[model samples]
Target: MSTILFDKIIFGPVHSRRLGVSLGVNLLPTDGKLCSFNCIYCECGLNEERRTRSKLPTRVEVKEALVQKLAYMQSEGIAPDVITFAGNGEPTMHPEFGGIIDDTINTRNQFFPQAKIAVLSNSTMLHKEEVFQALNKIEDNILKLDSVLDSRIRQLNAPNSSSFNFDSLLKQLCRFNGKLIIQTMFLRGEINGEHIDNTSESEIKGWVNALKQIRPKQVMIYTIDRETPVKNLKKVSGEDLEIIAEVARKEGFDVTVSA
Candidate 1:
């Protein structure tokens, strides 16, 4: 029962095998899913099968629908390499999410001032200091650590917070000192019979030792490209994500294998 929902509060410029020509921005409820992580490799599914009576899009309606879709994608010349705060759920759990990321960085500085403003966050709202200063005023603050083991993030990210603390979320991702961007999602699964894998080998050596204490400037591994509300999930290849991205590119970290 997978139900991808992004009924527009400024939707796609699509095409993103890792954020290229993105443009999505649904501050939850174009009708359901308000995530604080219900991720069975979610593509807008799961979270009680998408339920919403709707109401979470007013920061002046996400800066006037992102200034009328960046002024109609700059009059249809359509140039978007990333405006993505992602959709259907968890756009920093919107409560005026830092004034809508300061009106999408002043409407991406009046029409795609060299794009890039991403947010796809699941680092459980970074203990909210205005969502950690609006994800440190974005430019792709990706964030999401699939498993540093809170029992494999409560059986693969089922975190609705029973005080979900992975050492206080790795000290709030080591306070983003390396300017975040560590989005992992490797898979290998099962559900009612318990059997999952975060690309094991001790879950990529404790997620590359918490990315060597959150020194992430980039490290986005991928897997399960859509359609997963929980079936016999298993898609971690592209040469096993470049062998788990060469164990974080041999710890010098700038990994980005997307598969």
Candidate 2:
């Protein structure tokens, strides 16, 4: 079974395929996962295997740890391209999420004001006014939307709610007014004998139309780059990702391909 990948609240000035030289801030416990979706292609492992460890960190803990880390990096003369909010679970799930973002911005301004603040949100919390406000304050606000079709979303993300409103979520994303970056994962896979592939022509056709509605500033098309919980899954090729990116580009949207 795949276990937790991020073992600390603040981790790495590591290289990122999309966002360069990132320092990750994990709001959830390093040893466990707390997420709204149980995606088969998740690098942190399946939800069941992920919840057996540490508790979520408090807002103060996050602020203190982030500040300490930033200070250390400053002393070491290490410059990060971005301070990324990503880890084993959703960053917006934290109780004082808006407050946390504010603290992070303050710290970033003090230490690495040149660096960008980025959030890898699942878009589940966009319904919350505070969550939306916090995300809007950042430029690299990456949001996930694997598919526009509800059936495909269920198969791909396995969201916590069976009542996941497809239209409502899309509308919320549209509210970003093309300011958000759309992150789409393209893959072909089988789980428990069910074959699923979001790279199909029909799916892409609908997805392109959906992009037209959301009017994202950029669409990040990527395939699985790490081991996933589901062994049957396969990553879409770089060439294929560019093909999908081209479709979105033709629709008048800038895109980044990370295959």
Q: Write the per-residue lDDT of candidate 1 for residues 1-259, one digit (tens) a residue.
A: 6778888788878899888889888888888888888888798888888878878878998898889888988998999988888788788888888988887898898887898898988888888899899888887899888888898888888899899868899999999898989898889978889899878798799889989999988988898887888899999889989988987898899998888
Specify the highest-TM-score model's number.
2
**Deviation in Å, model 2, residue 109 alpha carbon:** 0.5
What are the runs in model 2 whose C-alpha is more than 4 Å off? none
How many clashes does the backbone of model 2 have? 0
Cα lDDT computed for each candidate against the true fold = 0.86, 0.89
lDDT of 2: 0.89
lDDT tens digits, residue span 128-238, model 2: 999999999997999998988898888889999787757988999999888999998899988888988998889899889988899988888999888888798898999
Worst 10 residues of 2 by lDDT: 46-55
Q: Give the top-scoring candidate (lDDT).
A: 2
Candidate 1, poorest ten consecutive residues by summed lDDT: 1-10
